[model samples]
Structure formats: C-alpha cells, structure tokens
Target: TLNSDTFTVTKVYSDASSDPQVGVSLACDEGGPPVTVTDSPQTTTGLTADFTVTGWTDATQVVCTATETSVPPGYNSSGTCAAALSPAGGCTITNTLNSGTFTVTKQYSDASTDPQVEVSLACVEGGSPVTVTDSPQTTTGLTANFTVTGWTDATQVTCTATETSVPPGYSSSGTCAAALSPTGACTIVNTLNTGTFTVTKVYSDASSDPQVEVSLDCDESGSPVTVTDSPQTTTGLTADFTVTGWTDATQVTCTATETS
Candidate 1:
C-alpha cells in the first residue's frame, strides 16, 4: 500500500488587489520553507503557491506557520498563521492593517528618604484589568516600567498606580491615573504626610500623702495609667504633678511638688 500526505501554505492580503508581495516561512517538528509566496486577492485563487510538503508520515501532524517578511503600505506585517499540519492541510497568514500601543510608568515623589513601600500598577485593556506589582518597598526613590504592546489601532488603555502598603509617618498620595491614549503614561507621586504635637498633663492638688497615687487619663475611662515620677520631661511629653505634702514643720502649705 502507498501513503499520501499534502501540506499547503496560503497568503491573506489586506487589499482587494493584494498589490503587495509577501514572504512566507514554514517550520515543522519536521522541517520546510524558508519558502516565499506572493498573493493577489484580485486573482480568483487569492492564495500563493502551495509549499511542497514532504517527509511527513501517513498520520503525522506537522506544526507550521506562515509569516510575512514584507508588507504593503498602511499594513502591518505582524500577522501569522500557526497550526498543526495534517494531510491536505492549509494555513493562512493575514496582514494586520492597523495597530497601536499603551505604556505605564510608576514614579515616586522627590520627598526625602523616609522609606517607601511597594506600589501596584494596573493596566486595563480589552475590558480586562491586569495588575503588576512593582519592586518591594523602596528605601530611596524609584521608578517602575510597564507597557502593553501590540494593541489594535485606536484602542484606548487605562493605567493606574496605588501604594500597596502606606508607610508609617506618611499618608497615601492617593491613587493616580494617566489620561487614556494609545501610547500614554501614568505616574504616581508620594509626598510626606504627617503632623507634630506635644502632650502635657496637669495635676491638681490631690492628697497630702508623701507618695500620692497620681493617675493620668489620656484616652478614655476603663483604661487607666499610673505615673510614678512627677515632672516627667521627654522629647514629646512634659507631665507636671502637684500634691500637698509635709514640707517644713513650721510651714505646712500645699505647693507644687516636682521630682526630677
């Protein structure tokens, strides 16, 4: 008995005339062209010469593709046909006429090195949102790059950056967004956000005991704190306590008592 195998490669042109010439290449788990095929839609066939198929067994499937080496004006050469070749198998490579791109960038503010956290970047295209995490929290400042390539012509993409974890002593710069465009950039900035204040507690005359139990109420009831020492002076705090106690035998007067 004799075996039979047939493989064909076809070219898909952008224009009705198929005025441009294109190069088509094919590769299989076996091997083939490096072959060139010119096509014309004007012709009733609308296809190029078939790639001579050989060395394929009776029931073996050949993996192949047809790619363009050159294309017509206003047409892109990014189209290709990838398929498994079977007996009498044929594939078509179309010329993509139009395309565009979109890019996103993650940037930090010029604030001092107060420690930065990782920022997450999101890109939305084709009605789907994909998120990419930037490098881990930055000690210094840093910038990250993100790009969505090979977009269809005139397609709009949205890019955004948000801090994954807002560091302490700083407030979120908030999420930032870039205007929609084929190839546009989105930038996010983080600024220093904080405030400073001193805490001081005043005590009234309580008891005359040599050691009085002084309590400081800072937050709320049910939660109490005891300050053993009076006149406590810290960088952000200055607590002063006053209590009547035995001063001199002759003069028994209540006065502000302070302990260094």
Candidate 2:
C-alpha cells in the first residue's frame, strides 16, 4: 500500500500478477472511495500503522503508508499518529503548528461584609430603628448647643447626663438644661441620644461648680419642669435647687395654670 497527498489509496502490484490469479478484489475499513479505498486513519508524521489486511499471506509484509493532502493557507499543520492494537493502545495524534490558544479563565470584591452593632436610647423599650449618631457630651461655653440628630423612631424626646467631672457620688439620668451663671459662663447639655453628644462652643465665662439639674419641657417654651420641686425665690438664685432629689428650673409655672 502506498500514500498520496489527497488521501487516495494507491495499490502496488506483485511480480506474479493479474492473469495467473483466480480472484482479485480490494476491501477497506470503510467503503472504498470512487477510485481509492481509505484503509486506515490519516497520516500523522513520523509514525507507522500497526498492520494492514491487503489480502493473501503470500507476501511477507504488507506495508501501509499515510500521507497528507494539500493543506489550505492557514489550515496546514504538522501532526503525528501512531498505530494501536486496542482502544487503550498508545496511538497518539499531536499537532505540528504550535500556534492558536486554548485558554480557560476565572474573576473575583474586597468590601467589608460583616454584621454591625448599634446602640440607641429607645423610646418605648424598642419601637422603630433609631440610632444615636457619634457626638460629644461636654462642651465649653453657654449658647453653643450640641445637636445629636440620628433618631428614626422617637417622637417626644428625653435625655440624661451622667456627671463625668464631679466626685464619685454625682449621677444624672435626665435631659439637658441651659443655665447661665452670674459670670455669664455656663454649660448646656442635651442628652437626647444614646452616645456621647457633640458640644457647641458658645463664648461665656461661667466658672461654677459641677452642679447638674433636670428640666423637663414639652418644647423650648413649654418648660414642663423635669424635676418636680418648688424653688422659693431665696439666697442663691440657681436653676438648680435642692428639695428632695430634684433640681434645675423647678419653677415650671405650674402645668395646670396654662400649658406651662
């Protein structure tokens, strides 16, 4: 058997030829093409076929060769194929043109995806979601108001100030009160939120001891008297006076007389 570029099978005749033979025919693995029979897989460079059934056993060896046809412009590539006795036989076909690419690719964010912890004042135990924003509590002067505004659920507001600078016995859990000292320097704190509130710096000279008072008012004008106590206008006129545990702006004009 001989090879050709167009994959057509070419037959070689023996010395003892045609006229002496009783029968003569050709067969291929697949049905023969019009003129040539394709007996084996196509030619791969540098490798040979296992065996070929070219008829009678009279010839010691029937060598089958493979060849490549004219490969079009970009289609041409050098390749090799080996013969195999079984399915797992070592018949490997490799490409000659080490050109085009066969690629496999994979993409991946570096954001913080952790849970958060929120602390709030909470009006009725827990109603809606309202968080106290980050702010400072103690400011320096008088009219400077520290506003802490991050409440999503509170309607009416109430606050508290835990005395930080005073001696150990001082403790407060109420709203803020604005009281101007005789020297005109004072501190006004609004504990309307959960965290440390921001302090507004209003220029004043209130150099007084750390005495806190609680003043409850519906709004700025109402003055509903946070700590219920009557301050008889006497010795030291302070927004903070002592009657039981109450102090600060105690004379709220009486809630029953008007709206106070």
lDDT of 1: 0.45
Instruction: Judging by TM-score against the true structure, name the best candidate.
Output: 1
Clashes of each: 0, 10
TM-scores of all candidate predictions against the true structure: 0.36, 0.16
Q: What is the C-alpha lDDT of each candidate?
A: 0.45, 0.25
Candidate number achieving the greatest lDDT relative to the actual structure: 1
Off by over 4 Å in 2: 1-129, 167-260
Please write out the lDDT profile of model 1 over residues 1-260, one tens digit for every residue.
Answer: 33334446566655444653545555555444332222311222335635544555533456656565555544566566666656446676666544333233334343445444366556665656533334223434444454433334334556666767655323456677663463455555554432212234344664333333223322112232222343345432243432211222232222233333
Candidate 2 residue pairs in clash (backbone atoms < 3 Å):
5-69, 135-196, 135-197, 136-197, 136-198, 159-174, 160-174, 185-205, 185-206, 216-226
lDDT by residue (164-205, candidate 2, tens digit) is: 332111222322321111121222222211111111222257
Candidate 2 local Cα displacement, residue 222, angstroms: 47
